[model samples]
Target: MCKDKIAVVLVTFNRLDKLKQAVEYYEQQTYPIQEVVIVDNHSTDGTIQYLKEWVNGKGNFKRKTVLLNENCGGAGGFGAGMDEVLDEVRRHELDADWVAVADDDAFPRKNSFEKIIDYYKSLSDKEQEDISVLCSRVVNCGKTHINHRNRIKQSILRARFMAVPEEEYDKDAFDIDIFSYVGTFIKVNALQKVGTTNRDLFIYGDDQEHSLRLRKVGRMQCVPSSVYDHDRPGLGERKIGWHSYYDSRNHVYILKKYFPIQCLIMRCIKRYILDMSVFSSNTQQERKLFKTAYMDGIKGNLGKNSVYKPGFEITDRKD
Candidate 1:
């Protein structure tokens, strides 16, 4: 028997088209979701209208939307969404035993949630007691694609730990130290203990930090039977553009919070070398932003985003 109903919280910004596709896919889940809570990070691209219309047109599942006033990035969006659902659960208004986190571009396989529930139900009570989060095998949306960004193999060196690669998808489920938010299944009990995602990190590495925080209370694993397709291409060495600031800054916070001193030092050296090596046409601007992120991170200054762009915040649902 399923002990608790599943609630999914998805965070979205300006990607209305992708978000629409994701919602349609989720609405068709074979196992059926109890509720879907969407956190819109102030989207100006008529996402609010789309969601309102979708909710009105669909009556099979409970849907809720939270409209933020500004662009809080993925970290803040997830934090806000999770806290809202947790509040409903605490108030006895929503009987959600497990909460799943997803990106707006993540489309799950029809049987994915079913597979997760089955694997979770197969675990012994003692085994279940030790597990906190269950991650899904995430792959690119096209044929013959391997997604290295979704999985990780823990190591002393930050480079090794952060970018652990799996060449292909596996059929078995196993424990893992790190994962992304593409399709992260977390237990309500664990949240009650470890708390929610960090809102301050704002964007990059927040998922990593949250996973580490969850580890302090329980274990995490990847359920290979469950899978999702992310509407993203395989990534290479990314240029330091607008994304570089958050990537550089939040990484520092993650290292400071979790890594040992020796590991931290080695990671710093390796990271510095890699950062310095990756330069393109906009090398000077990239270097300046990178240095700024590094210094801010070192100072532990996690203020509001100085570089974030907000989306439109509005309501179309009159009810």
Candidate 2:
């Protein structure tokens, strides 16, 4: 097994049980990770205390965990943790070959890191240098199949039209130029060259934006061998409350930043038409939220106070 030290950074808000499961999986990995940094986003629950106790229970790995104060959103937490890692690298306090960003709700297979190390080692120096981000195939918990459409859409949006077809997706592990932050293992130097997560995004679209920037520096690969189980529902079922706000606002934000106004208009038109076609058979609330969010997104008032604002904080179960 390659003994390359890796800095595993995780961000969590609540979901202590899910976070514990993720950490447990990390502890069972075949390859060695140098350190684990958990950033708690001001959970009103005793998540921090629970994590500290769990770390203490792990004999050798106990000393490897570090907890941070403050509830920076996922994007901000990643930026802060990466900054710490880079500082440690600069001071020679750490000599990690890679940095893995893991979501608190995600768990990788036991041999996931082993596979990553082997795949990384197989690459030539030039190929490694040219690689920006290395991503894994993520399966939702309890599901056997992959969501190819979601993966394709995410990859294309991140690459900003630099993506290739599925046939050309992987050319001997040297393919496309996009990746997701969740369950991703990135080269340290590549991140340094491309810069860290955009704190402004707070949460959504930050990964896509960072991956897009990384393309300017090097290539990104989606490794099918390294698999992780993400404990999140499908986007369609998961869409509710503030998730709608972030999704709609960020879509508009991305369009405004990267596309022409005419393109944005066309995209909005296409989106609503598709929604109307598909959602017409769905329940009234689903249709209402979908329409409202889409209209607010196109009007560039997605994040502003409106009728949609009241629904932003309502849990999906209640809605």
Predicted model with the maximum lDDT: 1
Question: Candidate 2, 196: how far from true, in Å?
Answer: 1.2
Report how far residue 106 has shifted in candidate 1, in Å.
Answer: 0.7
TM-score of 1: 0.86
lDDT of 2 by residue, 113-135 (tens): 88777788898878766776777
What does candidate 1's lDDT look like per residue over 1-319, in tens digits? 2384789999998899899899888888988788899999999999988877766666557888888998888889999989988999999988888899998988998999998888888888888778888878776755423332344444666433444346334546766676778888998888888888899988877888888888778888777678888888657775445567777788886777676656567766665665543532235445456666777777788846556323211123121
Worst 10 residues of 1 by lDDT: 310-319
lDDT of 2: 0.66
Q: Which 10 consecutive positions of candidate 2 have the poorest summed lDDT?
A: 148-157
Residue 218 lDDT, candidate 1, scale 0-100: 82
Candidate 2 displacement at residue 88 in angstroms: 1.9
**Candidates' C-alpha lDDT:** 0.76, 0.66
